[model samples]
Target: MTAQVQSAYAALRPADVVLSPDDLGGARATRHSFSRSLVRRAVAGGWDITLGRADLDEHGCGVVVFDVSAEGHRWSFVAFSQTIDESDREDRVVASSWDVTAALVDGAVDDDDVARLRPEVIRQEQGRADERTLIWTRANRSGRFFEYVVDRLADGAQPEPGVFGLSPYLLRSTAFYSNGKFGLADFERFEHGHPFAVPYRAHMLSAWLLRELGYELAERCAAARSETAVRLDGDWRRYFGLGNATGLGMVPYVVNHPEVLDAWIRLRELPLADVVARTVDRTGPDVPRVRTLLERAARYLAEQGDTEPTPYTSGAKLAAGLRPIQDLLTEYATYGTMGGAIEAQPWQHLHEAAAAAGSEVRGVVASVLTELADDLDDVVEASLTCQERRDIDPKMRCGELRGLIDADYDWLREFDFTDPTQTERFWYSSANNEEPRRAYAGVDPGERVQHAVDVARAVHALSLDLAGAEAATSVGEFLLGHPWHRGAVARVQSVRDLEYAELHANLLAGDFLPLHVQRLQLAVYGMDNYNPQSTDWLRVTLFSGAPRVADLVDGTADDDWSFTPQPSEADERTYA
Candidate 1:
């Protein structure tokens, strides 16, 4: 477990792994470490239920506070849940209020602190949080599901299991505010020795705790309505998770943070490549464990519901790719035996077979790599700290810059930026709230403040600017002449050395699938059960298959939930 041993093991692994690091799923797993870090904190008793009761009535309106103190860190999560009129309930960022408004404060909170934070958190983007708050967020219930569950519980019976299974979560957080937005704590505050310093620890922790609080609220309402009402089936409760609605807002994060993005993907890829180098012990007792992991993954993919497509990919396509790969893996575990051909470079061979099968299959293979090599999580987490800074080297010659572009961004050649459809869409921030918004280019009024997420266009324009410059002209001189190309040039130079650093898409393309970008990031945040609302946004569940807070408290929590499908009622009972 030492750093040196881990490094040696990684180096001994084959360069090629279960899937390419660039493979969408493998790349996504890197971001998924949010769960790992959260679980680590949970296991270590880093969080506390300072206050469990919600002071809400039958209409489900009230306040609840959760405080956590560990590793010399202290913060309180305060949520104000209220009843909203149907007319005021909207999912878009433009909406100002929600059924629940929450904030993570920098210190333990009391009745007076909750009173002070209530109005601001409720106002959402319109309100302000001082540095004392780390994150501000809001969620609305799945109105119909909420009513049904509440009504069923009020009647002292469990809602049909199918109702919970179809849409397993009660509330969907529409927005998360952090990183100094609204004068809250900037992420840098968590740097180095900070307790929740792992990337996205604050936001992920807030969201996870919010889900647990939602469950508490629901159960409290049930108990209030009917004295005999029992808690939601423990299995059903664990099956439920927090939901998030993501939009074009997330696309810029991937583009803006090349180094951070690269860190996530690279850390994940290292484990995969390391796992690929391992010899498959087909004859050893470890075979059953490996087979069980593969089977669970296969079952999850088989049941993954369909979603409408973006230009890039769809759930149906993912399912199509997964079934055959699952069968292949199942066959390997079933019929293939000791001294099988798979042992000859087990991971490499499986990866090749998956690639030969198809892109979706390759993605699943990458997703399963971390599970196959459980030790990789520790390695990946250790690597999360100590990110290398990526400063633009402006002193490079023009020819050298072009060569770098050619080596890394030749993918731009496939794009026709001049086409109307290619430049049809634009990403912009709303002046009303400064939240990210997408619009039709030229047709939309906010194009003036459009975000610079159009990397393909930026690169294309940079190439044109560079074409007229002398070959020996330094990049610094080129930037001095055309200042607009600086950001674009910096991206080209930085991403040239980072694998899976830049998203491969034309942001302005009429058919651009921002959902893929959203999925790519959210998947890293450990979201599954994707349910798209539109081309611009989708709702996904987090911690659906994860353990409850109580489970971890008593040391019964199992870390087997990542990418694993929720079991059916029959399966749960049978296994239990």
Candidate 2:
């Protein structure tokens, strides 16, 4: 699909399809009813799963080096599996030892690389960056399934895929490092495309590299147990996947990037709305394909067990709920869904069907849009661009400025994030390598040094200040008047056009937790294995492992190495 088709699809505004005023959840304040956040999160995570296979193709193992030929330097993540006292293991930001320790290897090295990386990767992760490495980090098996699967696999068996599910806490404990987050290379090497325009690709390189090292250890354990120099063959799913313990630090993205967030939601929602809006196949056989997609989504989600708020089952249940909407869509109501305004408008009918679905189905049907479009993933990836370039448009009239401020503050002020229901914790990156974490407002650790980058509150403040200021104030003038909120003002003033980006919360309020902000970000960018327990560490993947020499040799550039299929012709549609 071309970028033109993608953009044309995304440009469908709320006004184009909305029936009543049911835009933002309901009220004008809640008008952001179009939820791009959840759709984007699912798309990013799903994309990574597919990308993981590609990484596997690159490395011959279950991980692979991405498209990195422009810079031929081989950077591999050398992972080590050292059994530590389980009783002593912890998910705190300050814990020094983990079930695994990994380091990025620059080019092929002799004996010197192994000796240097072992102690250096371990201790420098204890906060020593002078190891002369590009990236260094470690992760505990966030799931007991790691040990369980190893036990099962060692007994000569393959564990079920369900063993690889993610938990919010484990999800919270995951982290990644760039440059020197834990004393590796400075981030500058990755800013341009050379070694890192591809962010997750680089970090996965490290994780996959480490996983290969685990194969060495597993081979050793197998040899000692069975009494031979046991060479291992076949891929092991039980021991794969990086473990991350996450917390509120990384769960807030669903609400923050409202516009970019909108892009993700819209892609999913628009397509879903389109599909449901279609005639229900009075004589067509395509209905089953749609139902099959829904079933696949439901089954995949069910495999995840559950998670709070938005449980894994929610996605499946969402699919089930839409079946009724499909039924409703079959026989047209006597009165048109939109009364008469958009009697023939398919998108408008979609809005009416969702509105009749109540809020729960409303949200669910809204989400089905993700599976409708051919280029949903592309729309999702496009949303990952940060609104760092957003500028405060100074051209708006003073009246508009005052109203936007008033409206923003009133909507955001409703949530008492400090209250148990509202503000349950605080978020911070621990000094122990800067991994993300969450603790009681006063207990966890660093409550004083909070990273309060919540855009909703910041934007609200900017609006209110602008509203109360002199009539002729430009956004720059307002920023100059209050320099502290400049970063936020820049974001708000510039990103007003992006409807799905803001989370409508005060990150500075006593209830604010930065981990939620971080998770929200990780989910949006699709960075898995980010441990929230390590507040200072942002666990990300790099080049994964090296791609298979066989595939590259066979001239099949389209190989999905993670789970490579039998060699085939060089089709031009490679999934990089």
Candidate 3:
């Protein structure tokens, strides 16, 4: 961390900060005041289970079963490891082969079950899983790093630490499947009484187990080749993480689950309000702590390389903007206070300063809040819930429904639907495996099967239908005549109170960048390394700086990995 950068953060404190409404916008306006009660919740409960591990061979071409039993419920995470030809190492959603395939079965498994699943699990999308399975996923190794580490360890030496920084994780999951697709257990089955009841807990746990499998594979392969093979260095192990490839297919989720999406954004913003309210003095003792946190964040941001080939975000812009904020923070640290006293709301004051600096700097300031507080865990738990039932108030008049749209979707009304540019793109599924894909409106072959992700056009068409209906007519009465409008009307009624429900921009517009949508959702997941491979798909690194599985399982873990990039090679060797 730079000296000035450290000092500038140390200068921040919440005093009698006050600001006009216009002082806050973008990153600054997003800040909120928080208290212990606001961010706190009942500590999440613990899970205890009998442990089991499989003995995979040196080649890693064998089965590993992990049996877990907690609170009278038991299940197995079954992994099938195999070698893939270099030509088979592709990351697209449609890829049919993988280095490893895994499944979380609903109960304890025996040899008979493994025999039945061996052939099918490897097939991935074409495989058939019974209700016994919870999730089916696959990962491909980071080819260069996997081979490099294995050979070095087999040669009785540690691989160069620098290799871990270039690409951290051994394998990256391309897809995670659940919810009864291809005959697996449906989500509703695991909603109540199941051990993995907290939404997608099954998937999350399965992915973590697969991460463990990756570690085991590398170790086993090394031991197979050399009697003096050594385990990966503990520091290097901490840097290991899972990578994911996401694309346009994930964009529809926010539109389809407006209530859930709104809840997530709403919870995130409230914490900012809470922090702003609680900050006391501009030069308070807490200034040192804030400064240290900001320093870590600034260093992490400084370390990001131009990894994405076609990034939606510009590295030059972020780098250029960060320097001035660092300089300002340095000056503020030395001065002790920006003004004579801490304002009535210092967080808001800080926010305004960041906003004035630039949008990118504002985001940097906003991220610093995570280090300052611990209450976000409760917010994260609340985000997992959704109002599953969406019943329309059929009695509401057509006029009232239109009023809801007019009030909530005013930005949406700006789009000119008749313009070809506004409706130039279409979203569809592939003919082979039904994976979501994007295509031009007139040029694509699958426009006839385009998914209903065009929320803007749907709303426009509904408005036209309502225009011809009687104002006094009930929505149910109108829907009875024009059944096609029911899905759009149901979505609008379900999300009328959700401020961040639908995206304000047109998804089908000529200039629409689906990468923006993917980044928005992934941000909620706390992902980093937003490396875009192209305009269509991108890769991300998760749990990169997080504690290793051994640390976590042994109760010696330090849970402070948020936004911290793995230290550069020099720092790695210094720590070693």
Off-target runs (Cα >4 Å) in candidate 3 are 1-51, 69-73, 156-167, 190-195, 281-286, 306-309, 313-320, 323-336, 339-341, 355-361, 464-470, 477-484, 567-576
Q: What would the per-residue lDDT of candidate 1 be over residues 444-508, giving only the tens digit for each residue?
A: 79887788788889888999889889989999988889999888877777667565666667778
Superposed on all Cα atoms, the candidates' RMSDs to the truth, in angstroms, are: 4.1, 9.9, 7.1
| Candidate 1, superposed: residue stretches over 4 Å from native | 1-32, 45-53, 164-167, 304-323, 334-342, 385-394, 431-435, 563-567, 570-576
Query: Per-residue CA lDDT of candidate 3, range 458-501, in tens?
Result: 88889888889888999999999999988889878988876567
114-194 per-residue lDDT for model 2 (tens digits): 565667566544655554466665665434544443344344443443344332211112345665676566655555434
**What's the distance in Å from true for residue 59, model 2?**
23
By the lDDT metric, which is better: model 2 or model 3? Answer: 3
Model 2: how far is 458 from its true place, Å? 4.9
Counted clashes in each candidate structure: 2, 108, 25
TM-score for each model = 0.87, 0.61, 0.83
Better of 1 and 3 by lDDT: 1
Segments in model 2 whose C-alpha atoms lie over 4 Å from true places? 1-73, 127-133, 160-173, 180-183, 186-195, 208-224, 227-240, 251-289, 302-410, 413-450, 453-468, 473-491, 508-522, 525-576
Q: For candidate 2, what is the TM-score?
A: 0.61
* Model 3, residue 135: C-alpha shift (Å): 1.5
